[model samples]
Target chain A: MNLKAVYIHIGWFQMSVTNLIIVIGMVVLFGLALTLPFPGNSKGNKKGKGRK
Target chain B: MSIMQEKEMWTSKLRKSWQKTLPVEKLLPDTQPAYVASWIYLFGVATLASLGVIIASGIVLAFEGASWYHYSNVGHFINSMHFWSVQFFFVFMVVHLWGKFWMAAWRGRRLLTWITGAVAFVASIATAFTGYLIQTNFDSQWISYEAKDGFNSVGIGSRFNVTNFGQMILLHVAFLPIVLGVITMIHVLMVRAKGVVPPIDAFNAELGERK
Candidate 1:
């Protein structure tokens, strides 16, 4: 894929590869966020110590 | 009770109700529970930040008029910021919604909070759809033409004329934004009132201990 080139265009509105990458990156980040455990729930805090 | 005493009783009742539902400590807590220090929790804040940017950039765009973005470099930059902020807002909101759903966030009498958040998400979609129709570009024209059929099939086309630029612009800049804002405010207030839902394991642990 031409990363610098336009990926889609409608009239004057256009989406480039960069835009696609940013959007995909954000989606992936959000997905990854779902799997990560909260700090308080992690094994280190399983005993409920070291928490406010 | 005398009339003056009755009035005082009513005022005190309101004050007590407010304090009971949202104590000052709960409303602005200095510390959050450990489980709240999670990546998923951050998505809600991220969505709020994106909304702030979207609104600020949209204000600038609105002041410059619909066509100014196409003609001026600064306007184009601000417009792009507004566009991307909206994309980020939806992405974050969906992630937050999914995370909450999987966590069963409606537990612990929090169904109202969940419902308010869900309603806010739907309102945000409507706000975004109107925004697309007011973009003043080929995308707007094509989308209006295409969306009209869908609206007509749903029997709402007559009520919402997407082809009418004036109507779309007003909905985009004024009415829909106000609706989204009010809904979002209620969602946040509900969250504050209910407190964050505890993890299921914690609930189970408490139940076991109680037993």
Candidate 2:
């Protein structure tokens, strides 16, 4: 029942390190999902070239 | 009114309205627009899949009982599955919300879709909170003790007693899930009705403008 949680303290702001990691991971994943091109799309190049 | 026309009954009116609002063709589309290609689109389905796993594992746990789950190896595994699926569900759902927000998914009269999804997310948080309170462990005890004051400050502590294990269990397993499920179903149906909101670039292209 007395488990220790890793915490990151900066000045007055403090949060569990685990929660901080999860938030950072979500932001990174969202960035990757937005920018990374879907694979196996032969038509993408031909179709995308027409648009800006 | 023609003689052949049947009298206007509530059942027929409801059926006609349902059909008109969600035509069968739109309900089951064979293809999507060319611009539907995006990795972000997968998160919504991923969230739904995690919900399926959570429900399946939860049904097993409910059938086996909490004491059995706490002590039995198989029950422990199922419990872990239920727990992890919930984690995945929230992660995927939040990412889906992010994607929708950036794309301005409420465009083209799809405000209801956005509203329902937002409502479902709030309901899901309530459901998760109740799930935590019903864990029947020291952690749950600590959480309930801490959360009671917050609820009391909001004037709902008497009505929604987090310390009541039986009430928490019913809310987690039954009431909250029903609310979340109904809202989720409406959200998906609205998406189906409106189709995927086109990208902002597509909107600009149609208007002969650039952003």
Candidate 3:
């Protein structure tokens, strides 16, 4: 539908090293949150139950 | 009631009344990071909101038929939203990711959150690549042919067929979203569940003391 996309300037908006850094940063944060156990779990704080 | 049913009832009955279980302050307590950057962290939520729009548009396009966007008025707008939404999705996702990174937000814990998200970010790249091809226009065809050389040169030729609408659409609308969404949802829930790490003042202090 967007034949005009051919004319769109990709180089102007393409992902670059800075964006890569931001993306990697995001991933690292997500990885940390998902991999390591929560700090308060030892206190018997509410854990994931509604997820099921 | 059967024993199992009886047990369920007891859990519900024994469950503390919502009001009594948590004091109002704790229930509505401050969990947001105290020194979270004053500029809007709300942008991440906005990116997510755009993605939500994309999914809705994508579902409609799929229902109309895979190539339906080539024909209908509604389909064109839907495609436009998908196009624009993706642009915004990357924009805010980048910022959101940066915010999390600069805040040293992952310091205290949440490694799984970080890793799953990283995988999803890679998936998004794949999803975007597929989206470019699925456009079914001149740019799509040109991009498909052009990008194939890169894949072929890299020897990943067998895994991806950039020109195939069926393959690209399935990967974009089905496979990649499932992976990204599941990870993102889990990450957000965990953030809410565990709360953000407080500013690393203590860790910095320890380092300062050590120095």
The digit string of per-residue lDDT tens for model 2 on A1-52 reads 1488889999999999878987888888899998999765546443332211
TM-score of chain B of each: 0.92, 0.94, 0.76
TM-score of each: 0.82, 0.89, 0.65
TM-score of chain A of each: 0.47, 0.65, 0.45
Q: Worst lDDT window (10 residues) for model 2 chain B?
A: B1-10
Local accuracy of candidate 1 as per-residue lDDT tens digits, B1-211: 5866865797887998898888887678666666776688888889999999999999999998999999899998999999889988988898899889988999999998888899889989989998999889999999999999999888898899889999999999999899889888888877887878888778656567642
Index of the highest-lDDT prediction = 2
Count backbone overlaps in model 1. 0
Give the lDDT of residue B87 in candidate 2.
Answer: 89
Model 3 chain A worst lDDT run, 10 consecutive residues: A1-10
What's candidate 2's DockQ score? 0.42
lDDT by residue (A1-52, candidate 3, tens digit) is: 4143233237677565545665676566555544454433234344434321
Preferred candidate (lDDT higher): 2 or 3? 2
State the fnat of candidate 3 relative to the true structure: 0.04
Maximum-DockQ candidate = 2
Residues forming the 10-long window of minimal summed lDDT in candidate 1 chain B: B202-211
Error of 3 at B81 (Å): 1.1
Evaluate residue A11 in candidate 3 and report its C-alpha lDDT on the 0 to 100 scale.
64
- Cα lDDT, model 2, residue A38: 79
